[model samples]
Target chain A: MKIAVDAMGGDFAPLEIVLGSIEAIRENPHMEVVLVGDEQQIFTILKENNEQKNPRITVHHASEVIGMDEHPAQALRKKKDASVVVATALVKDKQCDAVIAPGSTGAAVAAALFGLGRIKGIDRPTIATPIPTVNGVTVMLDSGANANSKPKHLVQGALMGSEYAKLLLGKANPTVGLLSIGEEASKGNEVVLATYPFLKKLKTISFYGNVEGRDIPKGTVDVVVCDGFVGNVVLKFAEGLVTAVTQLVKDGIMAGGIFAKLGALLVKPAIKKIGKRLDHTENGGAPLLGVNGVFIICHGSSKAKEIKTAINIAGDLVDRKIIEHIQKTIEVEGAFKYEYDE
Target chain B: MKIAVDAMGGDFAPLEIVLGSIEAIRENPHMEVVLVGDEQQIFTILKENNEQKNPRITVHHASEVIGMDEHPAQALRKKKDASVVVATALVKDKQCDAVIAPGSTGAAVAAALFGLGRIKGIDRPTIATPIPTVNGVTVMLDSGANANSKPKHLVQGALMGSEYAKLLLGKANPTVGLLSIGEEASKGNEVVLATYPFLKKLKTISFYGNVEGRDIPKGTVDVVVCDGFVGNVVLKFAEGLVTAVTQLVKDGIMAGGIFAKLGALLVKPAIKKIGKRLDHTENGGAPLLGVNGVFIICHGSSKAKEIKTAINIAGDLVDRKIIEHIQKTIEVEGAFKYEYDE
Candidate 1:
């Protein structure tokens, strides 16, 4: 299998992206990587790592780079030769089985929608993010692909998220839950209320009645489906909270005098382990599902290890034929036929 | 001043509620408490605590008690003498300066609306919850009051929340932010997009444009305003994540053998401090804003300490005349006059 990496995407672009691609290829000798960015820059980093002449590693030249602050669709339209767009195009042309873009999430989503297009019968593509839960991980969809979504779009997200869980988390029959404020079927906003009945009538996924925000981290359901707006807010809020809590702990230890400093040193390893367990990087990147091809979106600040894991995950998704399964599920279930939304 | 307490509300009813009310009156010698619940139950618990003869504490007989699982509005209509309803009615009848119900949030909200009524020019009453941030606290509003909110309601919420921060948080010119998926003005769903312009045009509040979910924890703004559905989900999700993360740290230590166990014992105090700082109980109950009377809603699982703090908060709100301030702001600013929505 071959993968295309958007070398100029993230904050530590070209350098970290090149290192991760090299590391992924080194670990999995059966696969190859195509680093899409400035040729000279990619080669310079490759030379520093002494893998400049490696047969498995290749560099595809792309002059333009989409900034982290750029408007997604407009940037993609203007910068035709942008690294992220070029990398996605490689997958579109079938030069690679999958593509990894570790830059602005908006840019990646835009490139996926523009380059690979949407799957048959899927109205919106979702960014399915794997959140760390107590028991294991829970996959939440539409984490920030589309700002606004219809009830049918959420139904499509549920099916796609379920399949992703089955392939990625190794769940035989993953339970899907609609994200809402309360557990009752009648308890959410207008969109959630409209989506609930349709989810219950679905045959493809095991539908859990309704799950609240607390249910996500408790591992109450394998797949959590919501519109992009709420999902994005939850994801970012969790991230900010974890960081703030960690800082609070550190400050507490600092204020505790000599005994506290000694204790913090002793428990540093245990605390580090806890941080690793809750870290988003441990799960690699979120997948931009519903796109015709495999596209993984990583955090802009992701280092080499996270990118490597994302590449491996992309390979697994490609081998598992996730898109095929999703397409079949949508067709067989006739998800859009429910027409519960008057 | 006299405050009415719903003695039969919370999980550890009558016992914790009566004890908390006793503690509050003991601390504030100037105030009195009316424990509204079953007369026999309240007296028995008070006698057990050796406070039955206390002159400052009185029992107001209420026959019905709304269960946590009961439908809020429906139960309030049927159970006229419910503890929460009677407690709220005391405030409405001007027999008590404020009311504190540490029971079902829905029931508390229902009782507040049904008994106290909405302040003029306010379409919906919001639950303004104080969340602990790294620096101090950030007050988030509409935290599960109105599941569906109109754009005008949000504008009213911002004005009310701003007044809440000024009186409760002690901020002179509290900045209000409309919670959305992104920080940009044009970044949210239909309601948020429509609310943004109104917030910006308001002279009463120090509008801070749009803030993301992470901003709540980061203390980016004094007031984080959103529709109740999204606000409730975010609140519950944060609670779950904090618990899950704490458990993860414990599990990590346990799984690391003898050294980890020894380190855990040493760092226990530092960890305990962090937990205490993040504990929502420390902040007491949420205030049901935009209501004509002072009504505070506590957690269903609140203990004596939490209830006591909530009683104190109720006193603070009543003393500050929060309802009057909110009403004044709404009328003076003519918040509904913006007419941004088509």
Candidate 2:
């Protein structure tokens, strides 16, 4: 399988991106990576890593780079040869099976939306992020992919999320839930309230009723759905909460006396184990589901290992035919459009 | 000051509620309690606690009780003598300074809205929940009070939240932030984006730009403003995340050998200290702001200590004249309405 990588997208840029591509290729012999960025920069990093001679990796020069802060839709339209745009074009042109970028989420989303476009029956592409639960991971969708979403869009997200849980996480008949403030059917915002009845009527999914925010960690449902606004807040709040707890514990341990210091020494291994589970690098990137092609958006601060894991994820999605499954889910639901004034 | 207690509200109602009211009255000589619920049940619990003759504590007969799952507004309208409604009515009738209820948030909000009504110039009442940050509490408003809110309502929420931080939390000039996915002005859902310009021009508030979900725990802003849907999700997600992290740590330590168990003993005190800092009960209840009278809502599963803290909070809000500040905020802002099709 071939994948396109936007090498000039993240904070670490070309160096980490180059190293990660080489590692991904080495780990999977059948996998090939096309690095999209400035030719000189890519070649320099590749030469330094002694990966210039690797047959599994190749460079595809792009003339421009989209700034992380630029307006995504406008940037995509203006910078036609920008690295991410070029990489997405490769996916459009069938040169690569998927596109992966560790850039601004908006830019990646814009590229996928404009370049690869939405699937035939899909209303909006969703950012399906894997939230680490006590048991495993729960697939939460529309994680800030679209700022405004209709009830139909959320229903589409639920379906896409269910497919993702099944194909990616290997959960059989993943239970889907609408993320709301309460467990009752009467609870939640207008969008959530409207979507509940639709979700309950769906024949394809194992529809659980509304799940509260606390249920995310409890793994109350394998697939959680909400608008991008709420989903993004939930995702980021979890990230921030984890960081806060870790810091507080560390401060607590340090503030304690000599006994605390000795205790820390003894519990170092256990702490490391928990840390590994909490680390963002251990999990791969979030998939931009419901798009026509496979696209993964990684954290901007992701290192080489995260990129490697992301590539592995991209390959796995292709191997499992996730996009096809998503298409099928939408088709089976009859692709019924429930339009709202955008 | 007289405060009405909803004796039939919470999961441990009548028992824990009666005990807490007695504790509150004993703690504050100037404060008086009017228990609203079944007179027989209240007396039974009061007798069991040996507080039947407390001069500061009085009982009011309210025969009906609103179930936890009952429709909030409909319940309030139908169950006129329900404990929560009766308690709110005491405040409405000027017989009490505040109302404290450990019940359904929706029921409490509905009761306050129907009983006391919105303060002048406020479109909808809001729930201002205090999130415990590393520095202190961040007063977040519209924490699921209204599912649908106009942009103007959010601006009013920010102003009210700012005043809440000033009087309640003792922040001199609490910086207000519009909770969004990014700090950029262009970021967030349409409501948030529209609310941005209005917030920036509000002279009554120290309006900072957009803040993300991560900023809440970081205490990046003293007042975090968002629509009810997002705010509720953020609040619950944070609660869930804290629980998840705590459980993970406990499991990790228990899985370790004897040395790890000894380490846990050494860190127990320090952990307790930090846990107290993160504890919701220590922070008190969330005040249903923008209402004509003071109404504080506690979690349904609240214990006696939480109820005690909530009563203390109610007394503090009444003492601080939070309702007057909310009125002043709206009056100063010119009571402008940004109309949406509701």
Best by the lDDT measure: 1
- Residue by residue across B231-332, what tens digits does model 1's lDDT show? 999999998998887788788888877877887777778778878878988988999998899888999999888889999998988898898898899999
Q: Considering only the true interface residues, what is the Cα RMSD of candidate 2 after superposition?
A: 1.3
Q: Please give the CA lDDT of all the candidate structures.
A: 0.90, 0.87
TM-score of each: 0.98, 0.97
Model 2: how far is B311 from its true place, Å?
1.4
Span of 10 residues, lowest total lDDT, candidate 2 chain B: B333-342
The residue pairs that clash in candidate 1, if any, are none
Task: Please give, for residues A107-154, the per-residue lDDT of candidate 2 as tens digits.
Answer: 999899989989887878999988888878888888889878888898
DockQ of each: 0.75, 0.72
**Residue by residue across B50-136, what tens digits does model 2's lDDT show?**
888988889999999998888888887788788898899899999999999887888888888888998877888888988887777
Candidate 2's DockQ is 0.72
| Alpha carbon lDDT at B139, candidate 1 | 93
Residue pairs whose backbone atoms clash in candidate 2: none
How many angstroms is residue A234 displaced in model 1 relative to the true structure, after the best TM-score fit? Answer: 0.9
CAPRI quality of model 1: medium
